[model samples]
Target chain A: MIMEKLKLNIKIFFEGAYLSYVGLFRWLSPSTYLATLIFSPLTQMLFFVLIGTYAQGTDKAYFYVIGNALMNAAMSGIYGVTMSIGGDRWDGTLPYLFGAPANRMTVFLGRAFMHILNGMIGVLTGLLWGWLLFHIDYSAANPWALLLTILVTTFSTSGLGLLMGCIGLITRNVMFVNNTVYFVLLVFSGANLDLATLPSWMRIVSNYLPLTRGIASARLIIAGHSLTEVLPLLIEEFGIGLFFALLGYSLFRWFEITAKKRGTLEVF
Target chain B: MSAIEVINLQREFQTTIGVFNRKKKIVPAVKGISFEIAGGELFGLLGPNGAGKTTSVKMLTTLLIPTGGTAKILGLDIVNDAEAVRPRIGFIFGGERGLYWRLNATDNLRYFASLYYLDPAVSKKRIPYLLEMVGLTDRADEKVEGYSRGMRQRLHIARALLHDPEVLFLDEPTMGLDPVGARELRQTVRNLQDEKKTILLTTHYMFEADALCQRVAVINKGEIVAMDTPSKLKDSVNDLSVVEIEVFGIPPETVEKIKTLSMVENVSVEDRDQLQLLLVHTSKGAEAIPLLISELNGLKLGKVTTREPTLEDAYVRLVGGE
Candidate 1:
């Protein structure tokens, strides 16, 4: 019986994840997906890399490349996952979702599952863009370690996305909130700037955020550092991601109860 | 056991009144209304636009929590045991909004079926059967965005029945459909009733309630004014006559003046294209017609006829033509 239940849950998780992702993007033409998942991020990366190389010289291009490459995870995690969750309300599926007998945790967490994978792809695309454009050296990097760092980073970023998605339930201006958070992470997650150059307060804020340690750890691993050398940062990055995901889940549950109590489940 | 039960259920919303000096006001949407449905009965809730019909349905479906009182679905408390109640009940709030328009009908059903925790084996069989039941089998693979209003509404019915829920809540299922579409949907609803699925339907069409429901509750201002079978509710207006005055551009004050006559029980206006049909319900049959015409002396009157009262007359009288 227990095995059956677990199997059912696992099925629900993957099916839900796939369906939601497909539901969200199926309307877009292939070119729109290319623009959103590929070209847009590419241009943003190029803009920052050009600026960074201009300021610190072309030799430090690798630093900016790795930093901006990981930002793709944030893009997918924050924007893509958020849209998947918020789309329920905008598309008028919230009531049906709330009315369903599905486990809330399974459904809610499944929302980020596809985006996590997408985020990993986005990060890889960004790294590939860097390799093709700037000749960044991946010869010394451990391929496994780099993959693990990308997974953790994307997971952490998606955790934050889940939280923002819950906030989308009550507020009308969710896009505004999403844009503000994305730009804030760009500045604070050490994605485009050196952590040492940032002020004491900024460094402290970065320490608590999701992508900060992930970005730092990615830089170390790409520079040929062993897993043990960057293990502490990876652990902290994973912890931060887990923390945000749980916080988001708690908020998601709270929002559900509160919306039901306040009769605002479909208010917006 | 009753398939659905309610006791003094209520819901209130808080709205801010002013911009700078915002004062909060508690507005009651459902004022402790109560009713019940038998296991296999088709029940209708008839009301005006803001008559708390949707709010009441929302609460019973576990989409919204009630501020007071209690409800049960098949003996499960709607509040305390919502999760247990959810799988047993399915609801379709009418219109094009509830569906995932980008996905094909089959995908939409599959997704919602998973949400209801139906085994893959069951949904695979159930999805196609439901599509056929709603007459959408041929177009099951088409994106819902391309579907007509009737088709979307039918798909909604299919989605709701994916789990074979024992009870269904349909809020204005045919709100904006053409006559033929409405008839087909109503037929589908009747078929569901024949299968012993208890249904709670809320609609503005009196004829629909008369045609489909075994019982209906006329609700107004968040309260049920009357609850009985269609014929019984119609019987309440049996003595009254409905004087429908077709007039061109009748002034609003004239309608109010007609209401002042002691014989007029209630008055409501219906727009029939360019002409307005003023419906006056009164116990004084033909004798009250001249008095009603006198109030509209200057207006261009088309046709004034008196007919026996219908379930709509009872509704207009019960809701006081709000």
Candidate 2:
């Protein structure tokens, strides 16, 4: 019986990923997909690279280009997870999901699977665009370390996304919160700037933000550092990610019960 | 054991009074109510909007926590044993909103099938069988966005049945369908009854309830005002007949004047284009028609007829003549 339940949970997890993929992109026409998934990220990367070139010459162009490219992944992770719940809520399916006999955590965490995968795709796409367009040097970078950085970064950002998604259960303006967090990651992730230049308090704040450690580690890997040198940052990033995932799971369960008590699951 | 046993179930909602100075007001949506349905019984909850019919269904289905009472579905406490109860029941709130518009009909069913933990081999056979039952076999591969309102409602039914649950709860299942669609859906419901599935249906349509339900509970203002088989409820008004006065451009004052008569039991209106059909229930049927006509004064009168009381008459009589 326990084995049967486990098998069911695994099936449900994949089913959730498929649903989120279809539901999240339902509004995207072919043209819209091109504009959103491809054209938009490329343009943003180019714009920031051009700005960096003008500000600090060709030498600094790689900094702004890589920074914005990594931010693309963060954006996808945050928005994708947020919309996983938000889409269900708007479609009037949240009540059905909540009322189903399935385990709530299993069902909800399943939704994160596709978004994290999509975040990985977004990161890789951005990186390729940088290498091709700006001609960034990849020969010196360790591919295995870079892969580890991407995985850790995706997990950490997705953790933050999961927590934000829980807040979506009670509030209608989830996009407002999602966009706020997205911008916070962009500004303080140490993606574009050297954290040493920031104020002491701001550096401390950046340490706790999603992608700070991972992005810093990514830069180290690209600068031809050894895996041992980057391992600590990647581990820290993974730990923070785990914390948010657990906290999000607990928050989700609490709000679900409160919604049952208040009869507010179908409100928004 | 009874399929459902509800005991003094109640629910209250808090609403803010003002935008600036928010003060919460606890308003009861479902007052303490109780009832029972035998296994495989086709039970109906009949009420107008805000009559607590849906609220009661929500609590019974474990979607909402009851504030004051308890309910058991298939011998499992809805609050304490919610997870156990969910697998045994299926529900559909009539509309197109609950479905994934981008997914095809088959995909939607398959998705929810997993949510209910149906075995893949079982769902593989069940999904197509349900689509055939709801008469959506031809359009099973089409995206839900392309389907009409009636088709979407049928798909909603198909989705609900993917797991083959023991008890089914349908809330206003035919609220916005055309006559043909509504009739077809009702036929499907009857088929489910033949399969001996315990069903709890809620609707505002009196004729629908009368035609389908074995027993119905009339709810108003969050309370059960009346409960019985349809025929028995209609028999309550056997001594009373309905006097329907057809008036052209009848003023509200005339309807009010007719209600003031001592013999008149109740008054309700139905619009027929330029004509207003006034159904007046009274102990004196034809005798009261003349008094009603005399009371209308200078209104343009159309054909006036008198008929035997129906379940609608009992409903209006019991619900204070909505």
Candidate 3:
């Protein structure tokens, strides 16, 4: 009986993810995905690579490319999760979702699963872009470590994204909050800038951010480090991700109860 | 056990009232209302716009938390046992906004079926049946955005019935449909009634309540002003007659002048395309028709007729002409 229940819950989770993807893309044209998902990230990569090559010379181009590549995963996770909830609110379907008989955590985390997967896809595609454009060498790197880094990074960052989506329950204008979070992740996740370049306080702040540890580990793996060499960082990344996922889910439930009491859940 | 029960339910919302110098105002949306609905009973809540009909339904469905007092659905408290209550209830808020316009009608129903945790085998059978029942089988695969308003409303009904919930709450389910569409939807609702589901329907249309509900509660300003069988409610205004005047380009002042008459019990206006249907209730009946004509001497009246009172007359008399 327990096994059957778990299986059912898992099925519901995947179905929720699939439905969310359909909701996100049903009205969107193909060209819009080509522009937003593909060309846009590649252009940002090219621009950053060019600047890094010019400022610090050709040697640092690989660092900048890999850094920006990993950040795409974070972007997709944040935008995907935040927009999932925000879009429901805008379309006036949030009330139905709230009134559903399903468990609240299952509904929310299930909706979030696709965002995490999309984030990993973004990271992998960005890496392909890096390898094709910058000729970044990964022949000596451990493929397993690289894949693990991408998965962990996407998971952790998606938790933070889910948290931002929870904040969207109170402030219906999620775009503003998402944009602010996106900027913070870009600047403070140790992606574009080196840890030495940031002030001591800022570097400390970067430690607690979603992608910092994951990105650092990814960089080391790209530089030919073994999975064992980066075990501590990977562990820390997993812990952070789990912490955020739990925290975000708790906050989501808290916000839901409060919104019901305040009668603001469907006001938008 | 009663299918639904409420004791002194209250809900107040804080809103900023002014533009520049905003003052936080506490609006009592549902104020100290109490009621009971028996199992398998078709009950109606009749009220005007913002009369807290939707708020009360939302509260009962566990969508909103009440500020004070308590509500129980099928022996489960709405607040403390919401999860236990949810699986047994379904609701459909009127109009097309609630549907996913990108997905087709079948997908919409399938998605909600999963949300209600219906098994795949059940949804596979139930989805097609619901789509056929709502007369959307032909267009079930078409995206909801391409659907007409009536079709979308029917699809909303299909989505609501996906889980075969024991209790159903419908808020203004026929608000914007054409006459045919409204009648078809009402037939579907009547079929559901035959299944003995406990239905709590909130509608402003007295005829709808009179036709479908076994009993109704007339609410005004968040309070139950009247509650009884449709026949009993209509009998309250049995001595009154409704004089309906279909007039084109009737000025507002003329309608007011008619209302100010000593014999005029109440006046309600229904706006048609270019003409206005004025329904005036009075004990004088045909005796007041000539008085109405003389009062509107300048305007060209199209057709004037007097008929007996309906549930609508009882409603107007109870709510004092909203």
Candidate 4:
């Protein structure tokens, strides 16, 4: 019986994940998809890379490349996952969702599952852009360690997305909040500036965030460092990601109860 | 056991007025209204716009937490056993909005079926059956955005029945459909009744309630004014007759003047394009018609006739023709 329940939960998780992701892009033409998931991120990366290389010199292009590449995870995790969750309210499907008998945890977390994968793809795509445009060297990198770093980073960022998605449930200004947080991560995740040159307080702030360790770990892995050398950072990054995901899940549950109580499940 | 039961159920919304020093006002939407439905009975809650019909339905469906009282669906308390209650009941708010517009009808059903935790094996068989049941089998693969309002409404029905819920709450299911579409939808509803599904349908159309419901509760201002079988409710106006006087451009003061007539019990107007239909309920019957025409002195008049009171006259009389 327990096995059957678990199997059913797993099925709900994946099916919800896939369907919601498909729902998010239902209006997208091939051009829109390319513009959103590909060209938009690519152009943003190029702008930041150009500014970084111009200020620090050409040799430091790898630093900017790795930093901006990982930002793609935040891009997908924050914007994509939030949209998947918030879409229920905008599309008037929230009531049916709330009315369903499905496990709340499964349905809530399933929202982030597809975005995690999408974020991973987005990060990988950014890295590909890095290689094609700037000739960044991946020859010395441990492929497995880098892959692990990307997964952790995307997972952590998606956790933040889940939290923002819950906030979207109550507030009409969700897109404004999403844009602000994305830019905040860009500044504070050490995506652009060198951590050492920054003030001590900013460095302290970076340590508590998701991508700080993941980005540092990715840089180390690419410079031919063994996985063991950066094992502590990877562990911390994974923990941070887990923390946000759980926190988001909690907020999601709270929002559901509160909306039902306040009779605002589909108010917006 | 009753398929659905309610006791003094209520819901109040708190809204703030004004920007500076905003004052919170508690507005009661469903004011402690109560009713029950027997298993396998087709029940209707008849009310006008803003009559708390939707709010009452929302609370019973576990979509809104009541401010007072309690409700049970299939013996499960709506508030406490909401999780268990959800699987046993389905609801359609009756519009194009509840569906995933981007998805094909088939995908929409599959997704909702997962939300209801239906086994894949069951949903696979059930989706096609429901699509056929609602007469959307041919358009099952088309995106809902491409569907007409009626088709979308049909898909809404299909989605709600994906789990084969024992009780269905349909709020204004045919609100915006054309006559033929509404008839088709009503037919589908009747078929569901034939299948022994307990249905609680809320609508403002009295004829609809008369034609479809075994029992209906006439609600106004968040309270049920009367609850009984449609025929019994209509029988409340049996001594009365409805004189529908078709007039062109009747003034508001003239309507108020006619309401003052000793023979008029209640007066309500229906706007039919260029003409206004004056539906006057009175025990005087045809005798009241000449008095009404005399009051309408200068207005251009059309077909003026008296007919037997219907469920609508009963409704207009009970609610005082708002």
Candidate 5:
């Protein structure tokens, strides 16, 4: 049964990647990419890289680029699921998904896996764009550990996305919910700046945040750290992913039946 | 065996806020409503908004957990054996939500078909057949987002029937379609009856119920107010048979006088013009028409129309309302 579920999850991943416009629109229209992913984090990252070159030193150039890379992946992971799921909630699309024959776990995992697939595409774009424009070197000596970092990063980010998706389900305000929560997480994530320079309390908060530990782990990958060196961070990052996935899966399962009983699915 | 049976079934929903804000207030959407829907029967639940028709359907379809009552499909408890019931049922809500907008009609069917564990060969073969069944064969390849309201409705119906479940629950099957589309959808529903799929059709449309349902339960305010065949419901109203007329020149006083006729039970002026009126239960409409014209004293009837007891009249009479 578990094997079959895993197989079904793969299919759902492909379905979400191929079926969702957020996944397919870029391929179909080509022009949709620049407006969606480009101006979003890519443009901001470029501006920050240029600013870091003039204001700070050469060290800050890599700092600006690596921070953008982590932020891009994090944003992809969080928004990929939240907005997609939020889109469903805004239009009350989750009910249609919930109305399917599969149980809640199947539905949540399938969609979450799909978001991971889409998020990878976004990660690819951010990495490639960063490399091309700023001539940044993303190559690592231990490519395997770097890949592992990206995997755990993807998990942690998508996990946060799952939690955000659940909030979208309950709040039914996709834009406000996504923007408000994403902005708050982005702040503590210190996605825009170096967290080492913050006050003691702020640094403490950033380092201990649900995504911070995971962000540090992902950054270790881009900077080409050994797996043994970052194993503890990897464990924490993977754990956060599992936590959000389980949290999201359970909460979504609960809200699903409620939506049906309350008849909110039809009203919207 | 009964297709659907509910015995004192109850469902309570608590509105809860964020993670720590688990305080809840229970709302009873279904108040222990009990009834049986027989197999191969096209049944209907008719009500206005918030009537609990959808709630009852969801519970029966295993989409909801009952709070205090028990509902069974083919003798299986919905809550305990929900997965079992879902396979035996085909469900559809009247909206564009179910089908993936970016995907073509075939893709949507294939997705839902896979969801039901339909074999790949069968999935590929059934797509066209379901599309043909809903009369969207030519439009099958087009993205559902581009489909018109009626076409999208047709595709949604195709998606519903893809699994070929024994019992089909359709909630407001034709809420937004144009008259032509509604008529087409009603026809498709009638054809489903011919196929002997036990169907529970809920709609605010009295005419749709009258035309399609073998047994209809009129639900209002989360309670079953009336239930029976359309004809039986009409009979329950104590229908004396009324004369309906639309005239351009008839005056209000004349309408009042028409009510005073020996056979006339009540005269109701319907349209803005006093001329368009309905004369109820005075004389059998056929015999009363000439008499009404005679009483008119050359008021010269403009548009005279008559009809047997209609579902609206029946509903109004039974519910003590309109």
Candidate 6:
């Protein structure tokens, strides 16, 4: 039975990828990233490259590029999952999914897993781009550390996206969720700056977040430390990821039951 | 086992949403409605807007859990064995949002077929057959987004039949179709029923219900107001009359006077432009028409017409319009 449900879930996920060309993926891609991923990583690799060079050709040039890309990888799932789900609600297709006979967990994970592929695409493109632009070693990714980083990132961010999806189900607006996540992450995520250099209270706040600990751990691995060296951060970030995912899942399930009960499941 | 049994089924939405963005607004959608559908029956649920047909259909199909009820489809509990129950059912709704807009019609059917866990080999054969059944085989490769309302509705039906379940739940299956399209859809529904497929169809089009359903239920305000064969419901209103009048425009006083006409027992103005039907009654529709016309033309009306009692008239009576 378990195998059957898993296979069903996998089939649903792949079917989603073939959904349409004129849809969220193509409509949402910034076009610049599109050019680089297909063949030329050197395309627009110069923006951050310029940022690094302007900072006086620091050997850490490659590090910022990798960091930005990983940060985007963490966020790309949000872009993919939340938008697709928000689009579903916005378009009224959500009721069909909700009404389907499959388990909510299976359906939720099926859609969630699709975005992981999207996250991997964002990560790989940036990795290749960084390698092409500078002498930075792509081997900086400690295999085990890299996998843990990705797993943690996808879970936590997808949780954030899932929460957004539920909220969008209520509001039926994709633009609202998308813009809100973008700006909020821009400010608190330290994506644009070094976390260690933040104000003391801000640094303290960063330490308490899954994203911050994730970035710090990734940097540690890139600097040649083993996975075990970041054990405390790993535990902390992993726990936060689980918390967000479980929280999002529970909230979604509750709303689902409430909507069904109220007979408002098809309000859109 | 009976194809469907719903006993003392009640779904009450908490009038108020609570906590973590749970705003409290309780709206009871289905209230203690109970009925049974035998195997191979083409059952119809007819209701006006806000009648809770969708909610009831959702419950029976295992899409939404009942707040305080138990329903079994093919002897599988809707809640406890939903996954097992799902394979035994297929559902279709005509909302444009139902199909994946990006996928072609055939791909949409194939995707749903996979969810039913049909063997790949079977889908390869079944999809073309099912699409042909709905008459969309030629356009099956085009994205559903490009299909007209009728085409999409056809694709939705094809998607519903992909798994070939014993029971089907269809909400407004022919809602947006034209006359020819609606006729084809009703025919398709009848064909499925002939194959012993149990069907639950909710539609505002009483003609569809009357033509295709062997047994029908009418729900209003979240409760079953009436249920039985369509003929019986219509027979209950046997002495009823339906009057239709076409006028350039009606005057307020003329409408008021028509209500007081000797044989014009009850009269109400129907705003044809808005497509809102109003019910008026007299012992005989023909007896009242001349008076209805003189009163209308007396007010300089262009034309007026009256006709027989219909499923629409029965609907008005069931909804307690009289």
Task: Please provide TM-scores, in order, for all candidate models, with all chains considered together.
Answer: 0.96, 0.97, 0.95, 0.98, 0.84, 0.83
TM-score of chain A of 3: 0.94
For B1-322, candidate 4 gives per-residue lDDT tens digits of 9999999998899999999999999999888888889999999999989999998988988988999999999999999999899999989997779888888999999889998878899999999999999999999999888999999999999998999999999999999999999999999999999999999999999899999999999899999999999999888889999899999999999999988988889988899999999989889989887788899999999999999999988888888887
Docking class of 6: acceptable
Q: lDDT by residue for model 6 over B133-171, one digit each (tens)?
A: 989888988978799888888787887777788899999
Give one digit per residue, the lDDT tens place, for model 5 in A1-268: 8887666666554554445534223233556545655557788778778877888765556666656666655666676677566556554345446656654565565566655655556656666677788777767636677666666777777887878877777764655766766666566766556678777888876654455665566567667777798899889878878888888878777777666556555443
> In model 6, which regions exceed 4 Å deviation?
A1-57, A131-156, A171-192, A211-214, A217-243, B11-31, B65-71, B76-84, B265-280, B300-307
- lDDT order of candidates, best first? 1, 4, 2, 3, 5, 6
Candidate 1, residues A96-213, lDDT tens digits: the string is: 9989988889999999999999889989999999999999989899999999999999999999999888888778898799899888899999889888999999999998899999
Of 1 and 2, the candidate ranking higher by TM-score: 2
lDDT of 5 by residue, B5-44 (tens): 8788776777766687677777777787777999999998
lDDT of 2 by residue, A157-259 (tens): 8888888888887788888988888878877897767788889988998988879888888777888998899899888999988888888889888988888
Question: Candidate 4 on A1-268: residue-level lDDT in tens?
Answer: 8887888889889988888888864325688767877888899889989998999898888898899889988987888888888888889998899889888889888988887887788888988999999999899988998999999899889888888888888889988999999888888888888899889998898888889988999999989999999999989988888888888888888888898899878876
- The per-model lDDT (C-alpha) reads 0.90, 0.86, 0.85, 0.89, 0.71, 0.71
| Model 5, position B170: C-alpha lDDT score | 92
DockQ of each: 0.82, 0.79, 0.71, 0.82, 0.41, 0.41
RMSD each, Å: 1.7, 1.5, 2.0, 1.3, 4.6, 4.4
Backbone clashes in candidate 5 total 5
Alpha-carbon deviation at B182 in model 4, angstroms:
0.9
Lowest lDDT 10-residue stretch of candidate 3 chain B? B95-104
| Top candidate, metric lDDT | 1
Cα error, residue B153 of model 4, in Å, equals: 1.0
B1-322 in candidate 3: lDDT tens per residue? 7899999999999989879999999999999789899988999999999899999999998989999989999989999999888888989888778887787888888778878888888899999999999899999999888998889888887777788888999989999989998999899899988889899999999999999999999999999999999999999998899999988888888889888999998887899898889899999999999999898788778889999898988999999999
- Candidate 3 Cα misplacement greater than 4 A, ranges: A25-28, B18-22
